[model samples]
Target: MTQEEATRLIGGIYDSIFDTITKAAPGGKPLMAPATTVLSLAKPSIAITPKDFRNPWTPGNPTAAGIQPALNTAALVDDAIKLSGLYTQSGVGISEVYGQVMDSVHIKTQAPNPANDKQLDDAFNVLNRKVEQTDPETGEKTTKTVESTLLTDYNTNMIAYNMAQAVYTAAYLEAQKTQTGRATWPMLAPNYQVPVKIAYDKWRSNFADKVEQAQSIMQTSSQNALSKAFKYAKDVFESYGVTLENVDKAMSRKIYRSTLLPSDWYSLT
Candidate 1:
């Protein structure tokens, strides 16, 4: 989902919870609600669990469907993705940027299955390096990298390693800045762990036992939804290159535009 949409959804949820509590209170005297980390709620886990072969968000809900591997070299992936975005936004070929990143990193290795973890790590070592070259005659040296190039490009905006993170950051920032979230998401100047400690305390002292009764229903549903979304994203993104689907373009065209039903429905009658 677009960051704005997720922000709205999360905001609505927070509002609903507050409203329900307010109405249920004895005399409308609002209970002092404790501010909690709003990070986890930025994009709550999906409550609709997808089945084995039944993709819940196949061609639909493209914004909500996306995947990125949990990896050690995620930074490398981000570097490439951001560079690609810089190129894409400026009307340049994404492939050109990818090639540049690969070359500078000294990535001479190739993997048959680029999606594999081992293979990605191999390429990561290369892509994660600084660009360098040495003059043959004069022994002069120079270095260049995508980040350096990006810094010089005037057209660069919304830098991101990949589309999914780009979208997530927008949503995350919205939640962090929202009125309700500011108190909850801030860093404690003196103690960084204050919020974390409070969260842990709250979970143990009040929330955990209360969640048991609804676990099956909430847990099952969310897991299913997440599964489908994750699969759809992986299907549309390749570890080594540009996204398989351009979400905006794909969502724009009419699904049945090519159908024999024809443009004029009255003609069938």
Candidate 2:
């Protein structure tokens, strides 16, 4: 996306997570909670378990209605998601910015050029030019030229490529600031890890095991729900890019939205 779009995305991500946590926690205590806090309340003891989804073929089971709530609970304790909040507030990390740059490069390479398509070329040539319009209800065959508002796949793709290029530029600038020393490729610079190691460490040491168990339980629940002819949960899961249809392609991308600034690059320096 463009620098402006990227900025907006980062702000939106921050606001979404922070605001949601604020509303969920009493007096917004979670927002001020230390990154090291284990958040034990998110542990699997209270979450949906594999036992809850047993017997997929059983009649009158709650498997179909429970997938979403289980997934939501799993997300609450996800390390990557927790780091996303810190990532937004800390101006993101070096690896995250580079990941976005890689995505932009890939998008730019895949975008179809207008020159490759004759019809699209012709359409773009007269994109802003006048086009004839007809008034069908007036029973008048009078033709008047009006500005062409036609948008084609080529135009849409080029716009996406331009926005991606803008993001690439922003990422490059971010890399220049985050890089520790000279490197052949600035975008591929070192220290590609998250900025706050303590947060990750705390989560791993105290919460990873329980969270993983909870996620496993939720995954089992999702699979059972999908297999039990739960179309609603299947459709909802697919909307989030998760599908039992292709287990290999469940999570296509990992980099999330967050701004970049050297001053906010804590611990990584």
Candidate 3:
């Protein structure tokens, strides 16, 4: 048979088998697209011209114009027939086939803590500290003493939190396959439960490290903001000749009316 004919024969057989299995499955439908492998006949051609009997001494040099058996069909048939079995298995919706495809793709889901408010708080704390720093040599102070409202924007922090949650969730799901007393599924027989658990544990540890890193950043920012606020308060107190007690009194009064001022303020001076 020609190579093209062999390819068609094998492909048709595999497709038939695949359809049968898909129909038998619980859903009675194929989960994926049908796959096909095609083999083309090798057509080796040689051109002959009226060059005369220039090389009459050459062996098999027929001085005639006719078609030659230039294609090899046997090898093509052998290979195509052998590969048909693989195609049939793939079409049957085997776990190995689907697992390979799933492994290559990532699915996103909602995080347990979608807001990541804690992580945001930590990040803000860290950034605030840096913003409040005063260069000892330059004697230059930060323009803003406190963190801006912009720092509390939750979008960036939520994304980081979600990424960490994804890693954790993936690890957890992988670990659940080996839970005690669970019936072993035929598809997962190749892998031991212990090894999968170990891998997932490692994944969880890495995710924790990422969360800590994020929290550390926020802590530093918060410290910076506190430092800036403290410095600003100290400078104001020194300029006004006001004692800490007077400052507290001023803050406690709801209105600046003289009647609302503390009675002991002048005695302290």
TM-score of each: 0.15, 0.18, 0.19
* Residue 208 shift from truth in candidate 1, angstroms: 3.5
- Model 1 ranges off by over 4 Å: 1-196, 209-269
Residues 1-269 of candidate 2: C-alpha lDDT, one tens digit per residue: 89999989867865666555444554545544444532222222343454433233112333655444333333332333334324222344444454444344321133453543444434334443444566789755555544343323334444555565565556556656644623534445323323234334544554345434443444444324344444443344334432222225656332222222442222222
Ranking 1 against 3 by lDDT, winner: 3
- lDDT to native, each model: 0.39, 0.41, 0.42
> Which stretches in model 3 have alpha-carbon errors above 4 Å?
1-11, 20-31, 34-131, 143-269
In terms of TM-score, how similar is model 3 to the real structure?
0.19
lDDT of 1 by residue, 1-269 (tens): 99999979867877676565444456555454434212122223323222211211223424333222111112212322222211222343344454454444432344354345444443333333467889999899997544332222211221222343444455557657767756654543224344445544544454334333333333334324455455544444333333333369655311110111232322323
RMSD of 2: 26.6
Evaluated against the true structure, the overall lDDT of model 1 is 0.39
